[model samples]
Target: INKDTFHLSQRDTENHQTNLQKFCRICGGSFKSDPYKRSYPVHGPVDDDTQALLRKKEKRATSWPDLLAKVFKVDVRGDIDTIHPTNFCHNCWNMIQRKFSNSPSEVYFPREGTMEWHPHSSSCDVCGTSFRGIKRKKRSLNPQLSKKPRMVAGSARKARPVRNVKQVSNKAVMKRIANCNKIHLSTKILAVDYPVDFVKSVSCQVCEHILADPVETTCKHLFCRACVLKCIKAMGSYCPACRYPCFPTDLVSPVKSFLNILNNLILRCPVKDCQEEVVLGKYAHHFSSHKEAEEKEGYAYINKGGRPRQHLLSLTRRAQKHRLRELKLQVKAFAEKEEEGDVKSVCLTLFLLALRARNEHRQADELEAIMQGKGSGLHPAVCLAIRVNTFLSCSQY
Candidate 1:
């Protein structure tokens, strides 16, 4: 094969050496950068041990092209045309592809070089300390391993590995803590006194198992990532410790954090009838299955000339007199839920009342433009049109 195959070029070797040196410089000697640059793909006579050693060394090497080959399959140093720039390398790529195989490109790689983390800590929650436990990557990849085929549902599946917590040097961690010393810890809950007595140790409040990893809200309230997400799911973005309003995006790298927490917590599906306890990382898929099943059951609450979810219509009527004042209050309460987008359904109730109150609001054209921008596709526009048509029909009813 060596006689027929192209040998490693001088330039390729030089670039490989340079990348190795760069890695050595960045990681010090704690890791070997270019452990096997000389071990080219053999055509002839290397011993099995030597070949195995070479492969192992190649795995540890971090050169972009080399790592690219190991991670993905095509040699990045070779014909770049053979692989797209977006090809996955093996490290975590298989899991990523299987999990998020259906996600929109926008969600997967929003921008180049953009990565985020969720913590898996071992120390004081508020202080965000990493006391002694080893930081291990907990991935969410089981759904990929299943051989059974499943139908796709609303939106593409956005399965991703849970976020990893940032591993700053102990010095950097202390520095960050010091920078926020002036930010007072809430006196409302003493360190010794916790909301749940069993939670006295640094365990997550949600499952009440697994040592908790600290996550912060914009309000600086500290809770286990899992517990806080559950609180957010149930209670919205207000700080549980204090009533301070916080945004979902401000929930300490939320998507990554939630994914990490979910990945780590493999739980049985809570829906009645199906009791599969998928790992948290696979929850997106489980929920997708749940959602598809729910859709097959058809719209539950449709009335004459009215869409399903008519109880929401009553809420809309109530919101009209008070301008959805009740929902405004309750909205904050349910703000953290995955169903919050459905809360937009609540807008139907409010809009209906508004239609009764005045004609001075958005004309159809203005509303269409707004919907187009937010919807991102023909389906959204069609949906908005259907909802508008429904409300107009309801007025007659």
Candidate 2:
């Protein structure tokens, strides 16, 4: 029994020595023992380069496990807890120290029921100036400085009492009278829920008369239809009010509601002795009737005249006929001149004569038809004259 126990003890000792020989003491790496090699102690203070190499190896070994764990989305703390406690490698420790070298080492943790300490600066950070108390100056004790002077109730200067004396001018009085007359005249017509001077306000800006068939331009200016057309013909394509570019085609008809309102307005007859107040829509008819009545009265007056008056009337008619014949002859001459290629002078002459005899619609119609038949050969001036004549005839109607 003693021999067998000794053999078992030797076997146990050899196994322990072999296991110890397989591992390095410094880096904890495994190695095989070789008969040709000599072994030395590796755990000791190394040279700077050797120490750096070991630190780098340790860092790489430690960091890879952490990085791999993070990449695989594994809980680092749980993994470490399952294996071993977390300890910084040499390089990591040095790196952390370098990163936070300027940071405070100790952080304050207030105890329960204890007030936290706060730090404050004694000087201004910007100018580095320390604060100091300043002494204020004392006021004088003289009576003038201490008390305000008082004046007697009656001694204060009184403001001059202003009296506005208005002087009445004769012209102003006359204007007021004219306004009153206009109001009186307007009152005779339909009663409108507008100011007494509203008629004047709604009058055409171009003609300074009550608007007839009012049209509004794109520029927002309002004008009578005929008045605006006349202006467009005279002036170029532009607004009269602000000179904004606007063409005749740009003039829009007033809204139907607006036209209805205007048509409802009552106006007095324009005839000298006629006192008829007619709605604007029927004014044309009323005026035509008045003209017909005036012509009949004129004819009756001539028929009721004595022999001498009849003779005088006959002579006047004969002279008017002679004048008409002369105008016809002049027109024919101008037309001949135009056909002979004297366009400018002939066109001017024709336009002037047509304008002078614009009231003769029959003659105007004949002239317009003749010029239009000439087509492209007609002078522009002559065409303008025909257009003006047409406008005048339409206006008369």
Candidate 3:
């Protein structure tokens, strides 16, 4: 190899070797951030601290290296743990000792190869800790390997800042010493655009919304699966509507009667352009067709990063212009609609009040043009209509 290639290969090999040295032999986990990283050398004189610790627990061993070989199933014969860190970490050492010490073994693993004490104190090449004796510290996990606890079931409201623990909004964290036992974490049916139905048979009693993924309770009460699941998780196995035992085990199915009823019910498409009635059971299948059509025309896409996502956003100014055109087209369509019964009955006081309020001489040039004058080419009547509509629009809100 050339001189440059040789050096580069050497550097990569060194890095690979270093990474192997960081992992614990027992659990195959890192010790880079572990302060209590410890190991009982495969080649051992059996340190005094280690012997005493074992004796206190009424445990005896012929050889540490032999014990490790049997437990780990590795051919450990070296004085160094550079390639594979086949040395027990602090936590793993204590665990393995307690587990294996229950019943002492005599002839399981015959001590393999005689061991001799090094002249000087044998120290770890990784953390610079001595391998001669046990120097135990408060056991802690490597922060790099440690993970934050999973979020519990609830709206994750940001807690307001307070001076003391007493001033905190919720005492749930303070009261509990362990992780929450509630595993059924799902979104409430009330939060989503659920089916609208007046029939009580097809509705969830708990959420008061039309049933979504309906599940039956022991008390013959029906509810949204998410609603009951969350209720059982938070409030225990009693029915919310009635104090009947509603545990998951107590829940039973009434055949497919609920689904049969649901399949017969009609639902309107949520998409604004095509609000046609469809069978509730087939709504999702019908919606997928609209979705496919929209995708082909570049009208709908995944919001996440990709080519399809950027289709509308590629030319920002052009996208805005298209949006403006659509809005204007909608307004034109609304104007063409026949104004029959109750057309004048709708609220217009907000419009009149806003129009009069903006008709002052001190208004900006843009506002002046909107009202009337030579700046705008619109008729007086048209200007009044425009002013009324603009002021009454939700943009003001």
- Per-candidate local distance difference test: 0.41, 0.48, 0.52
Candidate with better TM-score, 1 vs 2: 2
Give the residue spans of candidate 1 off by over 4 A: 1-251, 254-262, 299-397
Of the candidates numbered 2 and 3, which has the greater TM-score value?
Answer: 2
1-397 in candidate 1: lDDT tens per residue? 6644435444443433333322111111212223432222211233354345446545344334443333223343432211112222222222222221222221121111212222222232211212222256665566867765555663334332222223234224333323332222222222234345433333432233433445655543455555555566665544444434344565553346554643455455656887765654555677788888899778654466655543445676655647557667686556546455566655544564565457533343344445446542345566457557757976642
lDDT by residue (tens digit), candidate 3, 206-320: 5444566777764567776776776667765556555433467756565586578666667666678787877767766897899798788896434676555344456688776
Model 2 misses residue 285 by how many Å?
0.8
The full ranking of all candidates by TM-score, starting with the best, is 2, 3, 1
Cα TM-score per model:
0.18, 0.28, 0.27
- lDDT score for candidate 3 against the true structure: 0.52
Candidate 2's C-alpha runs over 4 A off are 1-197, 301-397
Candidate 3 C-alpha error for residue 47, in Å? 67
lDDT of 2 by residue, 1-397 (tens): 8899889766544443433344332222233333433233222233354345547546432333343232222233432211222222232222233322323232221112111211222232211211121234564566756575556656554322222111134224323322333222233354445675666556665554566667877556677677667656665555554444456776777778777777778776756887677877887788789779988987774444555543434567767666468666776687676566555457654664675476654444455556556534456566567668667876632
Identify the leading candidate in terms of lDDT. Answer: 3
